[model samples]
Target chain A: MADRVLVAKLGLDGHDRGIKVVARTLRDAGYEVIYTGLFQTPESTVTAAIQEDVDAIGLSMLSGAHLALVPAVMEEQRRAGVSIPVIVGGIIPEDDIPALTKAGVSAVLGPGASAEEVIGAVRGAIDRARREAGGSAPEGEPGGSAPQGEPA
Target chain B: MTRREEWQKAFEKAPLRDADFETMSGLPLEPVYGPADDEDAEYPGVYPYTRGPYASMYRSKLWTMRMFAGFGTATDTNWRFKELLAHGGSGLSTAFDMPTLLGVDSDDPRALGEVGRCGVAVDTLADVEDLYAGIDLEKVTTSMTINSPAAVILAMYVANAEANGAKRANLGGTLQNDILKEYQAQKEFVFPPRPSMRLVADTIEWCAAEMPRWHPVSISGYHIREAGSTAAQELAFTLANGFAYVESALQRGLAVDDFAPRLSFFFNAHIDFFEEIAKYRAARRIWARWMKERYHASSPRSMQMRFHTQTAGVSLTAQQPEVNIVRTAIEALAGVLGGTQSLHTNSMDEALALPTAKAARIALRTQQVIAYESGVANVADPLGGSWFVESLTDEMERLAEETFSYLDDLGHGSMLEGVLQGIEEGWFQNEVADAAYRFDRALNSGRRVFVGANAFTEGNDEDPIEVLKITDEDERRQVKRLAEVRSRRDGDAVERSLASLAAAAADPEVNLMPPLLDAVRTYATLGEIMDRLARVFGRHVEQPSI
Candidate 1:
C-alpha cells in the first residue's frame, strides 16, 4: 500500500507556491498526499492528519510562524494521541532547525531540498517513528515501506 | 533570402531543445524578426509612450534605488531603514509582517507566534512612529507595500508626519493602496471586494486633494507574477485593475486627470531578460493608449504609466543561494533597460528566511553595480529598435488586449464589475494556479532548467549563509508592548473612535478616511479598526479554487 502523507499550511501566511510545489512532487512520487490548503490552524491540520490516518504530516510555513505554529501541531498530535511523524519545510532559518527538531519534528527540510531528499525524509521519519512506537520493524535496520493505515 | 528564411534553415539544421519554440507563457516565437513585422510604435513620453515614460529617461537621472526592507519589531526595521538610507538608497519601501498584513493586533490569538516574523510588526501609531524614527518624512520618498488595511497604515503615517511637522502637500511617497490585486493574487484581503474598493477609492480621493506629491495607489502586478502568472497576465491583470480603480474614482465624481497622475504601478522583473523588458514596454503602451483613447484623459501625466519594478522573488532559488545574486543582477538590469521609475532587488538569501544585513547589502550593491557600471542605463530603451524586442512587445500587447476584452465581456462592459465578478468566480486565482501547476510540471519533467534545482545538482557543497531568525522572545516583546499601549491609552477614546468609524462605514456616502484617521489617532489597533469596519463591510472568505 502507498504511504499516505498529509501536507498542511498553517497560520496567515498566503505564500503557498512552494508548498504546492512540494505537494505535487510528493504526490508524483506515488505517495497518497492530502493537502490542507492555505490558512489552516494547527488544530485543523492535526485533526485532518489524524482523521486521514496518514503515516506522516508535512507542515509547510513561510511567514516565519513555524516556531510558534509548528509546536502547536506537535502538541495537538500528542493531545490527540496520534503518533504520526511530523516533518516541516519552508524558509526556515538554520538556527531554528535544531530547536524544531528537538521539539519532536521528525525532519526539517529547508529551502532547495530536492524531491528525492523530501521523499527519503518522509519515508525514513515514518519508519523510525513506527520502530520507536514498538510497531513492526527489525532492530538496528531501516524499516520497509510504510502501510496506508496505521503501523502494526 | 530573407532573415526569416535563413534563420528557419539554420534552425532546421541545428535543431532545438524541443519542437516548441515559445516564451514561458506559450507566446510562439519566430525564428527571426525584422522591420517588416513592425507595429506603429511611438516615442518616449508621448501619447502611447512605447519607448519610455520620460523623454530623457535615465539620462536625466537614474531610477530610484528603493530597497524593500522590514522585519522584526518596528524599532528593528527602523534601524534597517536608517542603514539603507546611510548606504545611499534613495527611497524606502516598507514590508509589514504577516499579523499586520492581516489587520490583526500583535496580541490577537490569530497572530500567535507570527509577530515580527516575515516583516515588521505594527499595532499602533507608536509603532509607526518608531518605524520612521529620526527619518525625515519630507526629505526622502517612501513606498509602503500594504493592502487590506492600507488606509489604517497610511493614516498612522499621516498622523506621524503631521506630528513631525511635515505638511501633507509636501510629503512625497507612495501608499500601495491597491485592494483589487489583493483578491486577484496576494489574498491578504480583510473585507469583501466592494468595500475594499471603497476604501481604496477613499485613499485615492484623499491623496488627489490633500497629498499632491503622494501616490495613493500603486496598481501592482508584482504579486501576480510572484504567484506564477505569465508576463502577459501580469500586464493584463494589473492594467485591468488599474482601469477599474480609475472607473471607481470617476464614479465617485473625481475627474480622471485629478487622481490618475497620483497613480503609479508596480511590476515584477522576472529572470527572462528580454521578455521582461518587452513586457514593460508593452505595459506602458497599453496603459497610455487606453487612458487617452478609452478614458479620454487629456493630460500627459494622466496618460503615462509610471511604474516601479522589483526583481522576482519567485526567481530566487534556495539551492545555490549565492547564485541568486547573479539572478538579481540580471533581473535588475532588465528593470532598468525596461525603464522602471524605481526598483527593489531581492536579497539572495530570501529563499531561506528574511535576509540578513549582509545579504541585503549585497543585493543593494547588485543594483549599484548595474547603475554605475553596466552602462545599460546610458541609453533610453536601448533595445527600443531591436526587431526581436519590438516583436515581443507587440505580441505581449496583443495578448493583453485580448485579456482586456475578455474581462470587459465578463464585467458586461464595466471593468470594475468584471474584476469583481472574476474574483467571485475564482477566475484570476485559477489562472495563476494553472500557470503555477504547469511550471511545476515542467520543472519536474526536466523541460525547464533551474540551475542547482533540477539540473547541475553536483558540486554545490558550500556552507549555508547565516539567516535572520525571529524568535519567540520577539513575539512576546511585541505582545507586551501592545499590552502597555492598551493600558496607557484612553480606552473610552478608542471605543468612541471605533464606534464613529463603524458609523461612517455603515453609510456608503461618507468617505471613511477622516473617521479612520480619527480612529488611528485614538490609538485603535489595526485589527480593531478593521474589525469594526468588517461589521459593516463583512470579511472576505475566499471560495476554494480547485
Candidate 2:
C-alpha cells in the first residue's frame, strides 16, 4: 500500500457522489487515493496512471459511455506496455459486466457490492497479480523497472 | 468506548475543530446546554419562533407535496408534470436543463450534447409554451429552480402567463434567483457574483412592483449542503447570503418590509433526522433575530422563514439502490417535522439514474403515507419542548451566529474571496477532507453501520432492472428543435434586444431588468443573452491552489 491505486473519473459523468465515497473509503482503509478530478479523458487517465505507476486503477461512472471509454483506456495501457489490472464500479448492469471484462477490465463492481467487497476485491486483485507475476511489485521509484528480486 | 463516544472523540480531534464543527456564524458549542445555557423554548407562536414558524404548524397545514421535476425536452417533461399533478402533488417545481439555466439554446455548440440531460430543456417562449401546454400557471404555484439567468427566465414566465390570459399579478411562483449560493455551491452561474447579485436585486425590485405574489429569490442551502458542507455550514452560509441580498435590495432603495416577506429559502434534508430538524429551528431563530436586530424590520411575515426542503440525494448509496427509499423516507420525516413549507422526496433510483416512473411514484407514496397514516402532523410542534431538540436547536443557532461574525470579520460580503481563500489555503477543503476521512475511518473501525454496504453486502450481483438511458441522440434531437426556433424568430428584433442587454449589463448604474425583459420578450436564446452578459461581466475564473 505504499503507492495508492489512483481512481480517475473518465469522461463527462459529473456525478461524483459514489467516487468520492470510494476514494475516502480507500484512503481510510490504509491506501493512498489520488482522485483525478472530474471530466478526465481516457488519455489523461492513462498518462497519470503511468506517471504514478499506480498499484491498480479504479474507474467510477454512472454515464453509459463506458463502452466507448473502456476500450480506449485498455488500448492506451496496451500501447504503454503496462498490463495493470483495472476495476470499475457504478450502476453497471450485470449484462454489461461481461462486455467490460472482455474489453480488459480485471473486475467489475456495481450495485449491491459493499465497501468490504470492493476493498477485498481490490486487495485480492493485487494479490492475484503478485502470485501470477511470481512476487510483490515495487513502489514506483524513479528510473525504475518493475521491482525485481522479490516481485513482478 | 461505544461508537458514539469514539465519534465524539474523532470530531473533537479534527484539525479545524474550532472552525469546522461550529455553528453557521462560528459560535462555539458546549458539550451540553441546560436551563442556564441561554433561554427558553417558547410556545410555538412566540416572537423568536425558535419553536415553530407557525402557531398551529402542521396541525393546520401539511407541508405542500411539490414535485421538483423537469428533464428531456419540454414536451417530454410536460407529460411527466401532468402525471405528477394527477398523483396528488400540491405544487409544481420546474427544473430547466443546463441550456435553459445558462441561457443557451440547446443546439449552440457550447450546449450541444448537453440539452435535456439534467432537466427539462427550454430555449425560448415557445419551449415555455410547450412546457405548460395543458397546465395553468395562474392557478398552480410554480417554483422555477433557476439562478444567474433568472431575470430572463422570469420574464419569459411573465410573458407566457400573460399570453395564456393570466393577469401578471395573479401569477404566483418562486424563482431561484439566488446567485450567491450559485457562486459558492452550485457552479451553474452565468455572470460574476456582483453583477449576478444586481440581477437578483432587479428581479426582487421589479417583482415587488408588478408581480406581488412572486418570491423572486429562494436563498438555497440545498446546493450548499450538496457541495459537501455540513448542516451547520448550510445554515450559516445560506443566512449570510440572505443578508448579503437584503443589503443589496436596501442599497437599491427598497424597504426591508417590501421584499423580505417574499424572500424564501431552500434546504436539503440529509439522513441526520435530529440534526436536520435542529437546523430548521435554528434557521428561523437566526433569521427572525437578524431581521429584527440588523435591519429593523417590523412585519412578522418579513421576519419569518419560509423554505422548501428536498431529501439529500448525496446520502443515497449506489451500492444498495433499493435502500435509498428508506433513507429518503427518514429525510422526508425530518423535513416535515422541521416545518418546511414545501418538500420534494428523491426517488430510490436516483442513486442509479433519474427516477423511473415507478420509483418516482413510490417516493410520492412515501410522503402520502407520512401525511395520512402518521399522526405526527396532527399536533403543532409535537417535539417542540423535547429536551434534546431544544438543546440542539439552541446550539445550532449560537453556532450559526458565530459563523456569520467570522465571515463578516473576514471581509464584508466577499463570499467569493472567502471561499477562494478557504479553498486555496486548504481551510474549507481540509474540513471536508477530514470529515470524509473520519467517516471512512468510522466505517473501517466498525463504529458505523452501512447495512447494504458492509454488513449485508452480497457477492457476484446480477444486473439491476433496466435503467432509462438518455443518449447523445436525445441531445442531438433537442439541438435540432432549438435551431429551428433560432431560425424562425424575428432575427433583427432579437439582435436589437440582445444589444440592449449588453449595454445595460456594462453600465453599473443601470438596473439590467427592463432591457433583459426586452431580450427575453424577443426570445433571445439563452446563449445569446449569456454571451452578452459574459462580455460585460466575464465568466467566473475559479481560483486555483497556490
Q: Pick the candidate with the highest lDDT.
A: 1
Tens digits of lDDT, candidate 1, A27-142: 87888888877788988887787667778899887887888889888897677766678899887777788889888999988766767788899989977887787758543322
DockQ scores of all models, one per candidate: 0.42, 0.14
TM-scores, each model vs. reference: 0.90, 0.81
Q: What are the chain A TM-scores for all the models, listed individually?
A: 0.88, 0.86
- Estimate how well candidate 2 is docked, as a DockQ score: 0.14
Which parts of model 2 are misplaced by more than 4 Å?
A1-152, B1-41, B98-105, B108-114, B412-430, B458-466, B543-546
TM-score of chain B of each: 0.92, 0.88
Worst 10 residues of 2 chain B by lDDT: B13-22
Tens digits of per-residue lDDT, candidate 2, A1-152, equal: 36568787665444454577778667767877777865566777877777666777899766555665777888977777766667888766555688888998878887545578778877776666666665554434312323232221
> Whole-model Cα lDDT per candidate?
0.84, 0.74
Per-residue CA lDDT of model 2 for B430-543, tens digit only, reads 444455445555666568777666566673154564455666676777778877888888999999998888888878778777887788778777677878889888876433
Taking chain A of candidate 2, what TM-score results? 0.86
List runs of model 1 lying over 4 Å from the truth.
A1-4, A26-33, A123-152, B1-41
